[model samples]
Target: MAAYHARSNSFPSRQHPLIPEFDEQLCRLRSSEAASSSSASLSGKLSGLQDLHDCVDKLLLLPLNQQALSNQKNEKWVDELLDGSLRLLDMCNTAKDALQQTKESTQELQSIIRRRRGGESSLSSELKKFLNSRKAVKKALHKAMESKCAFSLLNRDQEVVSMLREVQSITLSVFESMFFFISGPKSSSWSLVSKLMNSKTVSCEKVNESNEFASADAALNLLISHKMKNSDSTVEENAQKQLQELEMCIQDLEEGVESLYRRLIKIRVSLLNNLNH
Candidate 1:
């Protein structure tokens, strides 16, 4: 797919920029925290997202109700916008896959750092190289956002436009959640991330705050990031805590997906009512 680099200003009420960012998390621990269960939860959420995407795609493929149409039928907008929405959703899924890969990579990096005290340089170099290789994914993501944004302008006067807009918003929100756990592959981005994940001496608390963290959530993130930073705690203990956090995030995602599912259903029901009228 051509990398569709669409800026947010290309549409109105833009919530986030198309700038690329990568985020990922790694962990293991708590007696109550099951890596299996956390993994399952994440898997379930991704599946639910896939189901949602499929639902929209199927809806798009349905024949347009020409019988109920007026002379000014622009029903193709429905199909085209749904196509764009699906493209964006696919991009989000690819991002989810990338996040999953990062988790595995983090595990490998952690293990290597443990066995080879002097291997950090080589490992860091490899990680940065890996990130550069993923520039295509970054471009695809930005392009997907642009596609969704374009849907907003298409068929603006149509009733279905409102529903497509809602779907676009929900899809973007899901992407944001998935991206939270990932960090950039850039040297500086990975430098802090690796240290937080692997170095026992460095404290997330002591790290200088960046200007990007001006929101109230930034304070909470600092606390959570502090927890993620390595400490004197046993590896098992730390893993348990991290998994617990992961589980919480997954549960939140499940709720969001469920909510989205309900909303989508409502939109479908409303459309049916309109058609029958």
Candidate 2:
């Protein structure tokens, strides 16, 4: 919420016992985000963020850290941290909304497939509906991405504030990455199928295989454009498989984000309570 400035070298109290563990968790998360573009890895990043925030909350509970943060002279940084928390909450809630939308659409299509509701024409119609729902999700994700969260630099002596600001910065980065993952790469002239297949040199095997949503999209597109037969059991099976994978991924991400959201709430309450005291 404060004017964003580059504070690249900032670190928490050097002697704080929890700082090492916190740093390790943060580094692991950054490494995980950089090492892969898979939904599985993003789920891992969410877990690592939870651990990192737990450390932050623990630090907040320390007598010396509380004393520092609660000082009236530190009011500027306190306001910044509080505002940062709200931004994080907004980002988390947006991600949850997108994920929920995706989950519902996926379930609807899956149900139709399981019921063997109709012939190929009917299935194609439902698949088109599903794809259209995905476009809405992507639009929401794109707009959410535009709301940037920036962390501000604090005085060198404000160790606790510096540490929290760093946490906010990294958390913002991870959320942006998650939004991109959920949105499943922007559509272009290349087409989702081509992007999944030949867009990235290091892409995982199969079409957009690393991204559950993209893979599902590719599968559905094939069904629609190819006009596959209703009697083709493999066609239905593959579509079902992709949808199942997406459902599993959605559940994992939903749980992770919900847990992380709770952690953020707890941290915010702790900060408020400490300020009051």
Candidate 3:
């Protein structure tokens, strides 16, 4: 009986080392997974930051381009362009807000991970923070796009209209890309992926198509009006000279509009294909 008791006790003693060994192995595996997840989160955040930077760059350029074009146009166009400039500033502000929120979320996630004990999980807290940040980012992007599209539709300011159209198209494309990134197959979170992916593609395509048609129509109208004005001019030397200058300006505007249309079409096609695939 004493021998039996000794044997039974030795069995547990033999298994004692295995418990810590197994725990160590589990901890190592969990650590590896945590590290991978952390890396992925950081990479995603960096990509978002880069996108935000690009959007800001484009927003800055919008005002400068509008100013340059407005200088070459009528006073009405200048006022309109100035209004558009205010809208662009609004977009920049929204983007900055989103970026700020995302930065905070990232810092929070890092803090959670840092405070995690060995063999304890921090994934839930990290994912929660990330989702909150993503929601803010999406809201900001949506507001910016809506503001840009509205600005594009404003009448009597051809320069502002043109700049806003470009901004609208680019914003839609960027939003689609960001949506895909956040909801792609390899996304860390899977809860809302399907819903986001389903509706986004169709919405982007419609917006793009509508904007392209509007841009084309605006260009055509401008060209036709310029032609009509030139045709009604008297054959006086000064009138003829003015007509020629107007015609050249009209031609330049037409060419720029055509280029913009082609570029927008290309973007639309590419976005459609990407969405389909």
Best by lDDT: 2
lDDT for model 3, on a 0 to 1 scale?
A: 0.36
Candidates ranked by lDDT? 2, 1, 3
Q: What TM-score goes with each of the models?
A: 0.41, 0.86, 0.33
lDDT of 1: 0.39
Worst 10 residues of 1 by lDDT: 20-29
lDDT of 3 by residue, 25-102 (tens): 333332333232222333343333333333323433343333443343334443544454454445435544544554
lDDT of 2 at 59: 80
Backbone clashes, each candidate: 14, 0, 0
What is candidate 1's lDDT per residue for 161-269, written digit by digit as tens? Answer: 4334545554555454344333222243434444455655533343322211111112222223435433334432333333344334435544554554554554445
Find the candidate with the highest TM-score and give its number.
Answer: 2
In order, candidate lDDTs are 0.39, 0.78, 0.36
- Give the C-alpha miss distance for residue 94 in model 2, angstroms: 1.0
lDDT by residue (tens digit), candidate 2, 1-277 = 2222232223334565676677777777766756666777888888889999999898888777788778898878888899999999999999999999999999999999888677767878998999988889889888887866557677766767887887888888889988988886765212755553343332224544448888788777755655444465654676788889899999999999999999999989988986787
Q: Which stretches of candidate 1 lie over 4 Å from their true place?
A: 1-74, 115-149, 154-157, 173-201, 207-277
Deviating ranges (above 4 Å) for candidate 2:
1-13, 188-205, 226-232
Candidate 2 Cα lDDT to native? 0.78
